[model samples]
Target chain A: MAIKVAILGYGTVGEGVYKGIQNHQEQLIEKLGDAVEVAGILVRDPLKKRDVQPGTFITTRFEEILAIPGLHAVFEAIVGKEPGYTYLSQCIEKGCHVITANKVLFAKYGNELLKKSKQHGVHIGYEATTAGAVPIIRTLQELLKVNRVTRIQGILNGTSNFILTEMRANRLSFGEALKLAQDNGYAEANPENDVEGKDAACKLKILCQLAFGCTPDWEEVEVEGIAAITSGEVQKAEAEGFRYKHIADIRAEGGKLKASVKPIAVSSAHPLFSVEGVDNAITLETSLAGNLTLQGAGAGKFPTASAMLEDFSAILEKSLRTKIHLLSARVPV
Target chain B: MAIKVAILGYGTVGEGVYKGIQNHQEQLIEKLGDAVEVAGILVRDPLKKRDVQPGTFITTRFEEILAIPGLHAVFEAIVGKEPGYTYLSQCIEKGCHVITANKVLFAKYGNELLKKSKQHGVHIGYEATTAGAVPIIRTLQELLKVNRVTRIQGILNGTSNFILTEMRANRLSFGEALKLAQDNGYAEANPENDVEGKDAACKLKILCQLAFGCTPDWEEVEVEGIAAITSGEVQKAEAEGFRYKHIADIRAEGGKLKASVKPIAVSSAHPLFSVEGVDNAITLETSLAGNLTLQGAGAGKFPTASAMLEDFSAILEKSLRTKIHLLSARVPV
Candidate 1:
């Protein structure tokens, strides 16, 4: 048997998902016990020259993709909150699981969407929403079962960190570092979300809700971007044996949860002190597990696709309790 | 309905598992959709003083634990291989899922036992058998689905790492570091398995089997202990802007896997560079996700017990896809 899937965008992550399914179909089949087929792709312009699997349906209409029979999952990567959430909600209504890399939408509507998916007997995976390939969401979901998490600190935005790292490493001005990030394809043409701390704010909201089990008021989270951090300040921190990092921090202090996203100076011993480039790092301070730090590529085609694929694998594994990793039945001991 | 579980030992890990079950029953019920009760315990001496919940059965005999009504899972933390293997085998024969924290027994018998349990319509979880609380096993299981893992380097043994870090930071002799590790409860009195690199060898074998999909020949793994490192060597490495760490490395070289456990010098930017004390770290260089590193408490009661409980959560989650994290079914859009 083969599993049918769809994609909702034709950007970097969408292309990666399509390629990931095509290139690793054998592995997916081995692990999923079935071939995964990208049966349909929803793009804004069907006439655009895009690399797609031969004979797969390409359409600009979401209804055309949703009409596909036996669709198992949808990988969404569109850049907005409205249509993306609506398409995903529609997919859930049709009983197909949805996996996404859109944190902006999820941070706001994740509670409703997750609750809605449960009501529809479907799975929704957003591991790619925060830290691209870090698996923080799944880790928290598993750990929160038997542990009391005290605090969480993360370098959730890769662009901001990349800019900070560049400013410190090469003594580039903020505008120069931002230009370098754009030239290297690390930043979008309009890099407001990544530079202004809104991206990290959304990611923190999603992480905090999962880690603390409450939706915090967005207004209460203090937000500060690295735009105002001067080259001199970066050098000063370096001279003081510290590095400036755009950190998204959430902690419970005296029974109150405080959240912030800003540039902070950290010493050499910090887990994220050496985290450079466009990498993401997360530290979970839990009572039982002590401190756990996970680092991975914060944003990229393959990394985001990797998280979505993991979430898809999990959804399929749970759908039927498939014996992909289970060995054959043997005689009694 | 209440789920019944059993423990095969009553030492540090066993007591942690017991207390974890008692203390986190609320969270367990909230997550697993039913109360988790430690039904029975298999201890060496039944009369030994221990903290246990009232009305729970404690016995010296394995048969007594197997006799517990409605037993669902058995957590094994006994020392050595002989009886731990036999007892776990019996648990599988009785159609109960099994989780373990004994690496020595598992490194040898895991493949055979896992295959055997599959035939019995039961599950086997050994996350606690490797790095404590790191979740590397589960993370690898999920990532290996699509990502081609190229190499894995880990600080797998806490005692070895603790001693090495101490030797470097305090400029202590090998014997002095070993004594300090023992006093801190990081190393055992007879710490041959840890200091001699046998513990790391076992963990590396387990990780390689999962990542590479085939077990390498046990005799071919180049194992080197940390006992030979002098204080001068540690200082030399430090002076050269490097730290000597007990590293377990396995990478595919020219289509063949090379495995080794030894003291290696790593600079500041290395993922495991600042990993000090008893903290364990692992870096997986994957073809798709880039470099993913995870660090956490390497060896402890709560951490090890946390792994077992996560494994238990997975086992129960697979048994019946209860709506623990799922909300009430809602109307379609």
Candidate 2:
């Protein structure tokens, strides 16, 4: 049976997901022993010619995707809260599995959406919500099942990391670095989320939930972005034999989750100090594994899309099971 | 049907495998939906009276382990080339899945064993062979399946990392730091394998095999260690705003594999710089995923053991027809 999928946004990540799915079609088919196809793509501008295969049915309305017959899954690449939230909810309510790259949505409303997905008997995957391509979510949820995680720390935001790396390397001020990042396509025009630590804070919330099984309040996460740190401070830190890294830390201690996103003065010996440029790395300290770290491209078209493809694979596997658990009743927290 | 496992080598990593298997019993049951048990343990001293649970049949003989009726899997944690190699071959011949934590055996004899395992219709896993608990092998094999990997740069050995970290932070000489590492249980008495880059080189062979599907001649890999580095050089690099890191790099360029293991001057922009003290990190550059980095405890009882446990889980899943093809067959150049 061919699993039909609808992409909610035909942006960079969405296009990458489409391209990756097509490129690895043979291997994916061999792995799953089945076929998958992209049924429809929901684009804001249907007339916009994309780099993707031209025959892919493009639509402007969200309902057109939901209305597509035999749609088994939805890949939500649309960022922000309103329409992505509504579209994903509708898809889940209609019994379609959802694979999303929206960190803002998942961090804010994951608990709610997960609850709804459970009730509808579907799986909601947001692996691309954190590190672009690193399978940290699956690693924590599946592979590291027996391990009790103590702390989650790493470079979670790429734009901030890029800015910090630029500040440390080129001795550029935050503003100058931010401009360079924007010019390099590493940062969005309104780089508020990436600059103010909100991007990392959102990722921290998702990571904490998976590692600790506790959804931390985003507001409680102490955030200090790279915007506050001057080039002088970065140079001074180097002179003092320290590295300034934008670190997102979530510690599960004494039955409470304490989390923060900030620029920290890490000694040269610290693992976080070595993470440079726009790359993302996560160090997981667990009872069984001790300390494990994963690093990769935090955000990029291909990395994010590669993650989405994995989620697609997971959904395809789930579809093969006899008693499909699309939705389960929300467990009381 | 319950999948039975026999553990070979009752050392630190071996004990960790036992404890991890025991600790995650309930979760394993839930995930696998089957009963699993440790049928036997291969130990040098049967009467050592360690912290492991009672009733586990302990034996010093390879014949005894092979004789265990219905033994489905074997986890070999004994380090070295002789008995570990011989015993693992015996297990594969018996149609039992072989999971190993021995890097030397894998580096030298992986091809032969893999061929044998394929012929015998059994899987062989060596996730713990490199990077302790880090999932580099699996990441290369599974997560980045669609992407063509270009380069892999990592801090593959923890002992050398610890030594380098100490030399930089405390201004200790390489020899002095190595002494401290040995005293602190991070380095073996004969630390030549780690200090000379042989340990990392061996692990790099496995990484190259998975990442590029061609194992470069081990001798061709340019090897350099931190032994030649001094506190003065570390300070000199610091003065120039660069950090010294021991890095193993393998890249596929124009149908040829270029590999190297050395201590390089890394700017604050490289992901390998954040990897510190006994922790390992691998940065993979792929066509689809761009660049992805994974970091973790490169070596430790629990971390390595956690990897072995994952292999055990893989064995159980394979038994139930959920064959996880984490690695493709190495294509000979």
Candidate 3:
């Protein structure tokens, strides 16, 4: 049985997903024991020449995907709200397992989407929505099932980490570093989400949900961007034998969850101090596992897409079974 | 259906696995949909009053586990080669899924054991053999299935990392740090295996097998312990805007694998440079994902046991269908 997958969006991550799936087709088929084929691609501009190889069935119309017969799964790589979120909801409703790299959707409407996914008996995996390549969500949901989670502290945003690392190394100002990040394609043109901690906050919400089973109120999360921290502060922290890192922290206490995304002074003693420049590190403290840390690329074309591939593989595994109880519940704010 | 499991050694990791299994019983049953019960425990002295819960059977005989009718899997946490390796081989031959935290066994006899395991139709998992809480084995096995790994470098040993961390922070010599590590239960009184890079080398060999499909020749691997690195070198590295880290480097070039355990001068720009103290970090450079780094406690009772539980859950999941394939093959030394 060949699993037919349709990709929604033809952006960087979307293209990476396509290219990666093509590059490892034989190996993936061997692992899957069933062939996986990309049947259709829903892109903004279907006629645009992509650098990488994309299959023939490309379309600008979103409905073309929903109408495509035998599409077992949908890979949503579209950014922001509107059509991406709306289309994903419809995909789950139409009995398609969804793998998304959209943090904004998961952060805002994860509970709703999860509920719908369960009702439709489909899975909504957002592993790429948080940390690009790291399997933090799976680690918490599966591996740490037998452990009680205490806290999650992480350097979740790579752009901010890059800027901070540049400041620590080249003494570059925030603006200059931001420009460099933009040039390197690490930061968006506006760069508000990555720099202002919105991106990290969205990831923090997902982490809180997975680790504590509580969806944190995004607005309530105290966020401090790296824009405020100066080169002098970086030098001062260095002199004081500390490193400044933008950290997202979530802790569960007395059945209540508290989460924050802010810059913290990590000494030579802490693990996060060692994570520099566009790398994300997550420290999870569990009763059984003690303190476990996972670090990787927070965001990159192939890294983010690679995470989606993991989710895709997982969906294929679960879809082979007759029944899958996808958790969907309304988490109160 | 319930899966019956046996513990081969009632040591620190074994005890932790026992306690974690009992503590997370509800969650495990919920996630796996199978109740895992400890059927037997192998111990040196059956009469030794251990702090195990009542109702668990204890035995000194190795054949007892193999004879158990419902035994589906075995957890081997026993240290050293004497009976641990021999007993594990027996269990695999009897068609029992084996999960071991013994790096030495895997490093030396992994190829032989894996071949036997494949013939018996059982899976062999040693996620705990590397970084205890870190999911490097599974990450490489599952997540990077489609991607070709280029380079693997990290601080693979916790005891050595602790000693180096102490040496840098306290400005203590290597000997003094080793003494402190011993007193703090971080290192053994005879810490030659850890301090001499043998433990890390063993772990590196297993990782090489997974990453490159070639078993690293332990004799061919260049080993450099922290015994020679002085506090002066640590200070010098720090002054030169770098950090001295004991790194395990493995690279595959032109179908040839080169591996070494040595002290490397890591600049502030390197992700591993910030890993301090007893923390361990592994960086994998892949064709698709670029550089992905994971940091965590490389070894500890709870962390290592956590890896075992993960293996246990994975085995239970696979046992549902009784579909197990031996994926390890003997490579020429």
**Ten residues in a row with the worst lDDT in model 3 chain A?**
A324-333
Q: What is the DockQ of candidate 1?
A: 0.38
DockQ in order = 0.38, 0.30, 0.30
Candidate with the larger DockQ of 1 and 2: 1
lDDT of 1 by residue, A159-182 (tens): 999999999989999999999999
| Cα error, candidate 3, residue A274 (Å) | 2.5
- Per-residue accuracy of model 1 over B1-333 as CA lDDT, tens digit each: 899999999899999898888878887888778998888888888788887767779888889898888899999989999799999999999999999998989888989999999899888988888889898998887544678889999999999999998899888899999999889888898999999999999999899988897766779778999999999999999999999999999998889889999999899888788888898999999867789999998889999988899889888876764332221121111
Q: Which residue pairs overlap in candidate 1's backbone? A: A119-B329, A119-B330, A329-B119, A330-B119
True contacts preserved, each candidate?
A: 0.59, 0.53, 0.48
TM-score for each predicted model, relative to the true structure: 0.93, 0.84, 0.89
Task: Tell me the lDDT of model 2 at A199.
Answer: 89
CA RMSD per model (angstroms): 4.3, 6.7, 6.6
Candidate 1 is graded, for docking, as acceptable
**Tens digits of per-residue lDDT for model 2, B123-159:** 8888899998888887776566556678999899899
